[model samples]
Target: MLWETSPNSTCLHAQREAFIADVNRIQADAELANARAQLRLPSSRSLVASTKEGKFVAMTSPARLAVSVLVISGCRRHEPAPPLIRPVQTTVIRYGTAGEPVSLSGLVQAQNQTSLAFRIGGRLIDRRVSVGDTVSPGQLVARIESQDAKNTLSSAEADLASAQATLVQARSNEARYRSLLSTDVIPREKYEDAQRQLAAAQSRVAAAMASVRTARDNVGYTDLHSNVAGAVTAKGAEPGEVVQAGQMVLQVAQKGGKDAVFNVPATLMRQSPKPPPVSVALADDPTITAMGHVREVSPQADPATGTYVVKVGLDNPPDTMRLGSTVIGSVTLSPQPVASIPGTALIQIDGKPAVWVVDPATSAVVAQPVNVVRYDSASVIISSGLKNGDVIVTAGVHALRPGQQVKLSPPAT
Candidate 1:
């Protein structure tokens, strides 16, 4: 070091000594902090300068300046890091009585279905209508062999004509016998016999006329006619097939009304006894829809499946709701007070259902046991263990632990 000093050298020397004193004070403070914190810091004793130096110089010594910088750096106090806060999504619970809407797959059917059958047993000669064919009232749907019926009708007519001729002859004979009795030419017993013969002939003619009418009806029965305007949904017998009396030949679905038939699970049917109006729509095309009320429900569950058949009669259904078309029926149950939460929030603890609930005061989560009333695809119906204003964790539930600190994300816009 070199000293180029003129007068006032004493003042410069005093300033240098004061700077050294400040550095020494900082070093003492660092040492005290290390002892109190029990931290194993690097020794700062080596950086302490001697109280006396040999001579005053114009420029400071590099070794002494390095010591001052080290002493200043060591004076900083160490602080512990802040606690970890995990960000999670949460939702508030709101209790309400709105039950979830349930949808069922079903088939569109006629409200009034009729099965056309032959009135008498015979070989089916002709089937004029097939499946999906439309027919009007009194339209000929099918025909059975009618040769026997026609022959019976002809025989009845012949008997009727014979009885009529006999009745005429008996009346003439009775009139002639009465005139003879008046002239005392015939006995009274003979006149009574003629009257009895006339009565017998009249009764026979009436019976024969009845037989003719019956035979004619039998012939007409061979040709099956549609009594209602509808479309043929099915065909039971083909041409040349022998069918019995009252055996179905064709099934017609009446055109005026339609029904949506559904096989509903027993659980759902039990939940809502008097179900509200159902909304029915085509399965393939949703735009075609109709409102319906439950018209009938099967008394017993199906043997194959534990479900009840529900028939919903549609009001003024569209033309597209053809018989046998696939449809979807939705039944909205009446409302009941129940709380709903997202399905992701549910967890199992000790084989029981639970959820992670947030503590507003501490911003921590705890596992809460909840009574689940029902389960939906995306949410759960909670009947107990949750109340209004309770906040629950929705996502990342598996990763969370009891009493874990959390920061809630802002609600979605």
Candidate 2:
């Protein structure tokens, strides 16, 4: 260092040293900035940086944010989630003190139904009435051919006339014979013969008279008459059709009384109390209702339908309720204690019949299995698994779950 050196070499050495010192100073500054960042605590709004693929991503929350940086340098964001609240409808179930009424579909029919037929065999030459035609008592409804009948009557009349003439001649001979016997002008045997002849002729006349009356009656049998005032319900024979004796020709429904005929189950028939009052209503017009009583119940059940035939007699039924009209009959039975709920409230949970019961305090629902006693058109009778004063979800049952919170809507007025 004491040795004298060239000016150019000295200048080059100084420049190299200065460059080394500047590199050290930059290194030290980078270290100091990293240390300061590590010492500071993270705040709520602090930004966290993560490296994914080859790019950096910044997120607000470390626990909730999932950052996935694209290899091509892009960002994707997701919005916050909202709370879940379901709206539903509920109903308060109560036990029915008045038992459920049984309703059955039936047909309105005349109480007196008769089948009209001919008494004698003949060709049906005329039919005066058709189905639904009104007829009165002693009204001629139909007639058969009268040619043969008339001929028979004529022959009987001629026989009767001949017998009458013979009888008169015989009586005259008997009188003459009796006068001769009294005067001893005729033998006793001859008088007895004359008396026998008169007796035989009188018997012949009596027999002929009976034949004539029978012939007259036979002729009358060719005509068909209605014995009651009614409407024809059916026609079995047509004009010019030959029908046998006692063959049904028409069906007439007599006027005066109406009956509601219903086919009821055997259980209902057995359980029905004595003198149960039945109420009947027209299927089309329910407002036209009539009070009636049980008229007749079939002792046997129908094999095909397994139901008993029941006839209910209407008291003073209106004329508007025509024959063969559809009707509905309702009968009230003895009161029974049973829990009843709407059919809509029924559901299936865990492969069992169930309903949703709501907790009043928590407004949560739980699926409760129930013993179904009977199912009706709009309601159901529960035998067990349910009690009175229990709140049940009637509507929106399919969208509910156990322990799920719900907001109930106001009940319908």
Candidate 3:
């Protein structure tokens, strides 16, 4: 005898309530702080506990009354969502009309990429960020050996003070000499010399001020910093390494980094599709999504490539992408008529682009493969497909092959 399967008469939601309560009690007994906890809905399903692994540690999933029991490290917890009853299938279909816009391929670049270096040559005494280190604007990068710079600054300050003192003394001497000359107690030449000394002292003071400026500038150079917020793509010199003025020390990619290039066909350009927005899937991490923008479009097209070069700029490039990562992305830009059809309507015949055309008169879809010029959001631009007023199977197109009979009504309506 064969047993027929049917939906359970009982709702799992009511039964699971008691099970959930029991799980909660166990969690409380474990003394795990109820950090970010939630009960799974009846329709949803989940184990009592789950574990997540990180760079340094791992947390095991807790067991539920229905499933397996587990031990976990007491640390942090995730903001849990309502549990899912069963695994759900997920798919993403991106469709767009062809458009034209600029494209750039690059790592996440700072708006203003800058390299911090010393104003004067010195040994690097400290470095705050290494390659792949993220830094904020005005954050320190490194400091140069500044003992010499400080000494020079100190000496200039002392000279300035001494010159001022000399100026005062010279003025006093001049005044006394003038009085003597007027009274005929001293020769006129001596009075002139005293006046000259006063003038010299003033010049020395001005010179000292210039020296101070130089010294102050030198002191500032001893400390290097990033001018903009971004990750350190490269390092110039290590700590204790000597660097000279104007020497390149580091390379940084500005946020919204490098450009993505695309070579599109000239015929497609005529359609004038909107430029494709860009995103990146890094070689190191294909799962993480990144945002980017089209930055450039070359008017000229290369016949050999049968396309024009378009560039895109990426935002928030991961460390892997920060140092110039290779990535591939789509540029959805085309000019054509839009259509919304079931995914089943698409068919390829004779290794050429084609689609099935459904005729309302006969209630039949005929294979009429046409050139798939480009894709629009939720539709496709067919330059040589079916004409206006032509309809085709939107659903279950895959089930029917070429020259196969199709029924008007199916059981799974």
Candidate 4:
């Protein structure tokens, strides 16, 4: 090609060579820049080595290198820790019988308590029984001063006697007057006057008889007697104390049946369809238990306590069961189908009661709304939203999230 080549062709060849040379030069300059950058930057291994030595012998200043190394280490350390799977205790829910038994504190009392008082007012003269004294039917409990009663009775008797004498005389006069009128020995007006006198005398006699009876009754009332076999619980009068009619002088508790009296909430009374059977235990002696049944329930709620007074009659109460002793009554209700779980399993979501339900296949938890029937001391009774064989997170419920994987811990020993 060089042998006798044209000038134009030679010039084109020289231009092509110059273009190739410029491209080579540019490429070489880029490579050199890249090398310089690599030398200035600190590698991971080199930085670690520099940290161990507490100094950097590389082209870069030690301060810059140290800062870069710390930043890189911080990034590596802060890289989001792998999400941890929490281990939680769980329980398998099953449908079973559940009921709320209302327990109440009550006092043991006699079924019949009587307050004895005088039917007539007078000064109390004698008290035959003291508090805690056992008494029998017809036993004298107390007596009022009877001197005034005796005097009144005597006056009534005297008046009755005088009235009887007058009545006898009047009868005799009436017989005589009738005879005289028939025989025409006296005027008709005289006979009529005699009949009127007899009638007035008969009225007086009748009045006197009534007064006598009333006086006798008043005398009898001065003596107070026990109507039932019982023990005296209280005494309101002492000798020489003036008492009013119908004022309570003593309180007697009858000896037969005992009752456990409780003030129960009105809500409990409404919820129970019928009076539930109860078991009573003495607060002082818990070992002493007796069976009982509801005897009475107040129709109206007490305004002060907002409760109803309930009386449970004890069956064959023991001798040791005394009046005024404290007792605890426990009642059991009919069984209902419900799911029972520990209280820890319950959680609230969106201001509503909920529970965490675990998916058996994926071991993940999801919040589920539940109808809570009852909240007991240690457990909760669920009425709806779960069925038999449902696994629930009984523990670690507060630290759970929706659709979070978990591992079931071993059951507690």
Candidate 5:
């Protein structure tokens, strides 16, 4: 029953069966590789296949080959990242045609502050006014113990009474001696002696009168009075404290004008003798503002702070600008052509001031030495370091070195 099979047909069937087996093997290998990939395992670089002619050939799938290359390369050490290029804010230098304005902290004060004190020294018995109490002209502000003063007055009055009695007796004796002399009942020498006694008594009476007046004044001085209408700003003495003559008992701020007081540096005080008007405003609330002019400056600097006291008289200040209130004062110097820069841009080099200047062509920063005329809170006046067109890095100056490369921030929108 075995029919003779054709040789060509046998060969063809064998080839077809082998090809189908190879295709199935390839599919299985692909599945295994996909599963390994899902499990995050390494995949083989190539697969082996048997051709119909019974020869083995190497085959690499495009997806698996790409993944294998990536994995191998990733395992290798990475090169270091590029150096960081920092960005910085910058400003173009410009010279001020007008003088720069300077601002300082100040305090509101009374333009005419007068210290109320006793003309005579005594123990303070009663203080009629406390701090911040309103007072009027000739108002009694305080009083000292007047017992001693009254005793002194009583003694002066007794001396005056005695002198007056002696004067009356002397006048009577002189008149009686004159009448006796006219009637030849007494000698001329006696009348002259009576007249001389009367003169001496009159002189004693005059001196006693002066003593009484002085005592009266001392008694009146025991009660301290305010010469001007104002408010009591301070108290230097309390009840039961012994105070000296001319010692401050109460500080009264007169009702007329107000002043903004500031402590200015000696360098600033050496400028123009007469400065321009100052703008004063409340420290917490700037909306409450006023204008003022320099009314007085201390002839000598303070020994503690080495600063001069400057008083600026305000023009019609608001009621809320009371004495002792904190305020801000601003003064503009006379116009001069000077260059100034932000304080942040200024850096120190070898104990001298310098700045980071940007090169327009290379965008590199270089430390250029600068001569600073003065330094303020927000700015520095340049005497000879920077020019009008020089560009300087305003921020992050401390982080940079000479010849460092930097990127400029875009100008503010």
Candidate 6:
């Protein structure tokens, strides 16, 4: 607003015209920018103009100074350049293949599974093993009442004694009979009857001995015994319960060699080739990753879930990865060639896999979508939407836009 009004008319008129032209140029640039912004288009504010035959006219020679001062001092204002658009140097891959790692999840299971049962039936009088009880091979676990077996043993002893007494009497009578037969004191028919009675008594004794042996076996069967070394995992019958023959009274499990089973899509499981290598981590703590190999892959899928049973056997299994412990398995499908790149380069475009490719000419960034087949430990496999050598944004997606300037950074070692 403060200015000196000069009385020299021609010079003042020339100066006013030059100032007006400068103002027009600034207005034009602002209008152009507003229109481009409305269309969401990008353009640089740098102007390049050349005039070969310049007209002889009074011009604002200090146009830059005038523009800067007016704008900063609020006398005149100029539209600004878009905020410094920096390119994020990202690593990327064109569509290609590489061997990649995969992992699957599973839970620990007892490998040697068995249900402990009784062989013969009787009242369970005593039970030494309960849930969580440990036992060795041939260890007695429980016992049943054997009153009938004891009675049978006593009866068999009486039969044997009676047979022995009858045998002695028969021998004495035979001696007398032999002497009598030489004279006529005793008849042959009487001696023959006595011999037949003694033979019958001997047969009865043999039958009783067999019965005693059977009774002894029955008595032995009344005591429940363990046949393997393991811990009792379950107990269905109590001491007072009368379990029948071959009933599951206890469940024992061996101490080591556990496995994990998980259901996977049928397509993922391959039976023709050897099963894929896999790694596992406990769900409670994923950092504790345990290496494992595929133990089994069921040929069929579960009808309800449409998944095949995939078993993984662990090595150096963590203490936390115990039986019934939840775990996640990364089942490695057979490795195929894939483009390996750092994970920082990945971005999402259109709600799908995407990355920013560096332009060869402009050195600007342009978004490109990609299909991530899988994530290896150090790199990623892209199934599609990339090239083998195309430069991609690795570190900065938020700082990027189309046609943005870039600075190349060294790849990570």
Question: Which prediction has the highest TM-score against the true structure?
Answer: 5
- Cα lDDT tens digits, model 1, 150-220, are 99999999999999999999999999999999999989999999999999999999999999999999999
When 1 and 2 are scored with lDDT, the better candidate is 1
**Candidate 3 or 2, higher TM-score:** 2
Model 1 regions more than 4 Å off: 1-96, 273-275, 298-306, 337-413
Candidates in order have lDDT scores of 0.83, 0.81, 0.60, 0.81, 0.83, 0.70
Which ranges of candidate 2 are over 4 A from the true structure? 1-97, 185-187, 336-413
Candidate 4: TM-score? 0.61
For candidate 6, the per-residue lDDT at 92 reads 40
Taking all chains together, each candidate's TM-score versus the true structure is: 0.59, 0.58, 0.43, 0.61, 0.68, 0.47
Candidates' RMSD to native: 18.1, 17.7, 31.8, 14.6, 15.8, 18.7
- Backbone collisions counted per model: 1, 0, 53, 0, 0, 20
Model 2 residue 3 distance off true place after TM-score fit, in angstroms: 86
- Candidate 5 residues 1-413, lDDT tens each? 01122234554455455446656766777666655655766657446555586444546567754654454344444567886667999888877767678788999988888898999999999999999899999888789989898899999999999999999999999999999999999889999999999999999999999999999999999898889898999999999999999999999888889899999997667553376779999999999999999999899899999999999999999999988999999887766677878899899999989999999898888898998767877888986778888889989998998888899985321
Candidate 2 residue-wise lDDT at 261: 98
For residues 1-413, could you state the per-residue lDDT of candidate 2 as single tens digits?
31123234554455445445544654554444444446654423334453454322333343322221121112112355764557888777677778568889999999999999988889999999999999999999999998888898899999999999999999999999889999999899998998899999999999999989988998999989999999999999999899999888999999789999999887667657788999999999999999999999898899999999999999999877889999999987566677778899899877888998888899888899998766788888886887777788888888888888788887432
Put the candidates in TM-score order, highest first: 5, 4, 1, 2, 6, 3
- Model 6: per-residue Cα lDDT over 1-413, one tens digit each: 21124444554555566566767876676566556655766547634232355312222336675754454344322566775756456654544343344555566877786776767787888888787778888898888778866777778778777777877787777777778887987888987877787777677778767877877787778777788888887887898888888998888878787777787765455422365556788887889877777777787778898988877778878777777788888754555545767777777777887778888787778888877765756666676777677888778777777777787776433
Q: Give stretches of model 5 more than 4 Å off.
A: 1-92, 183-187, 266-275, 349-351, 356-369, 390-413
- lDDT-best of 2 and 3: 2
Per-residue lDDT, model 2, residue 315, is 96
Estimate the lDDT of model 1: 0.83
| lDDT (C-alpha) at residue 229 in model 1 | 88
Question: Relative to the unseen true structure, what is the C-alpha lDDT of residue 103 in candidate 3, on a scale of 0 to 100?
Answer: 30
Candidate 4 local lDDT, 1-413, one digit each (tens)? 22123235555455445446645654554455444445765343222223353343333346644654453333332346776688999888788775667568999888999999999999999999989999898988899988888899899989999998998998899899899999999999988888898999899999999999999999999999988889888899898999999999989999889999999876567556486879999887889999999998888889999999999999998878788889999986566677778999999999988999989899899999998866777988777989788888989998999999899875432
Q: How does candidate 6 fare on TM-score?
A: 0.47
